[model samples]
Target: MVKVTFHQDPVTLVGNEVKVGDNAPDFNVLTNDLGIKSLADYQGKIKLISVVPSIDTGVCSIQTNRFNEEAKELENVSVITVSMDLPFAQKRWREVNNVEDLELLSDHRDADFGEKYGVLIKELRLLARSIFVIDSNDKVTYVEYVHEVSEHPDYDKALEEAEKAE
Candidate 1:
């Protein structure tokens, strides 16, 4: 279990048992297209999974757009945005924002993805902000659990970590 805090208050999570250099955990998540996808779908590719509370908010949109612009240029790289938002909402956000590069996946249906990754916020119908980077071999290499729910992550550092994994 991982102990994280929001506004200085502690919350607990049963984090994925997988560790750095270990095989990445695979789970299915709903896509904006209303399709199920798994980690194996992007096998042998470098990936950055961005877990956010919601995309309708300003901060989420900014982070999504930032990574969408920066990440698309890299070859064999998959940048995914995960949220508790329904697939419909995800699609709308992507369409309205012209978010073509970053794939938005939803955990509203089953939320197994969040549960497996330990990002599910139990008290709230949201997912904790996190960044998980997996390497070409589908091994976890970098991870960050944003302790505060109201803040943005260190995108620069996360990108650097992804680059290192590449």
Candidate 2:
């Protein structure tokens, strides 16, 4: 488990992140359209898994935009933003915000994907803001634990590491 501080106190994640060299756990997630998707769905492509608490927050929005920006030049890479928001909300956010390239995935129905990935906050019922770069074979090549929930990650570094994952 990973210890995180949120709401001025500490919370624990269900499990630790898949290590840098470990294979990412396969999970079924709902897309903005409520369609089921899995890590396998992104096979043969570099995967940037932007795990967020919720897109309603400032930090989440920042991360989503950053990934979407970085996605422009990264060929064969899919930037997937995951949160606990409902698929309908995700779609609305995408439409309103013009988030065209980035895909918003929701974990509202079943949170097993979050737990399986070791990012689900037990008490808060949210995901810790994290970034995982996975290779075509679903191996975790890079990982980041954004300890400060309100802060954005080092996008330049994460994107640079993503190239290596390819």
Candidate 3:
């Protein structure tokens, strides 16, 4: 388990911590249309998984928007943002923010992604900020567990890894 902090206070993260060279865990997340999306659905494509507590917050919004912008330039890569926010809220946020490139998925159904990826904050029932890059074969090539939940991740490094994986 990784020690994560929200607002600079230590918090416990639930589930196994994924590392580079490990096979990416399969989990269920909800698409904007309330359909179930699994890791298997993204097979054969490099994946950039951006985990955030919620898309409604300032930092989370910036993180998602940044990746959404970068997703436009990347080829053979699927950028997905996972959060504990409800599908309804995610849909509205996408519409309001006009985010078109990145896919926004919800972990509200079972926290399946949150637990499998080890980003779930036990106390808050939200995900801690993190980034993961998975190659086309579904092997994790890069993993960054952000120390502070409110802060942004290493965008350059994560994006670079994703590009290299492609």
Candidate 4:
């Protein structure tokens, strides 16, 4: 378990924290259409899994948008944002923000992704800010668990790792 802080207050994170060279955990999350999606669904492609507490917040919105833009330039990579927000809210946010390139996934159904990735914030029922880059073979190449939930992740580093992963 990783010690995560939201606004300076420590929060407990559930599940094992993924590390570089570990096989990316496979978990189910809800797509905008209420369809079940799993890491295996995106097999054979590099994945950029962006975790945020809520997509509606300022930092989360900025993080998603930043990755949305970068997703367009990255070849053979899928950018996915996971949050505890409901599918309805995620859909609305995507439409309101005009997000097109990345997939907005909801962990509201079961928190499977949140728990499996070790980003689940026990007190808030939200995911702590983090970024994971998985290579085509499903091995994690980069993992960034942001110490502060309210802060943004290292976008450049994650993107670089995704691009470098073979």
Per-candidate TM-scores read 0.92, 0.95, 0.98, 0.98
lDDT of 4 by residue, 1-166 (tens): 5677999999999889999999999999999899999999999999999999999999999999999999999999999999999999999999999999999999998999999999998998999999999999999999999999998899999999999987
User: Candidate 3, TM-score vs. the true structure?
Assistant: 0.98
**Residue pair clashes in candidate 4:** none
Angstrom error of the Cα, residue 154, model 1: value is 0.9
* Over 4 Å off, model 4: none
Q: Write model 2 residue lDDT over 30-80, tens digit each, in one string.
A: 987778998888888989889899898888887898788878888788888
Worst 10 residues of 2 by lDDT: 1-10
Q: List the residue pairs that clash in candidate 1.
A: none
Residue range 77-123, candidate 1, lDDT tens digits: 89999999999999998998899888999988887888888888777
| Deviation (Å) of 94 in candidate 1 | 0.5
TM-score of 4: 0.98
Worst 10 residues of 3 by lDDT: 1-10
Which candidate number would show the highest lDDT if scored against the true structure? Answer: 3
For model 2 the TM-score comes to 0.95
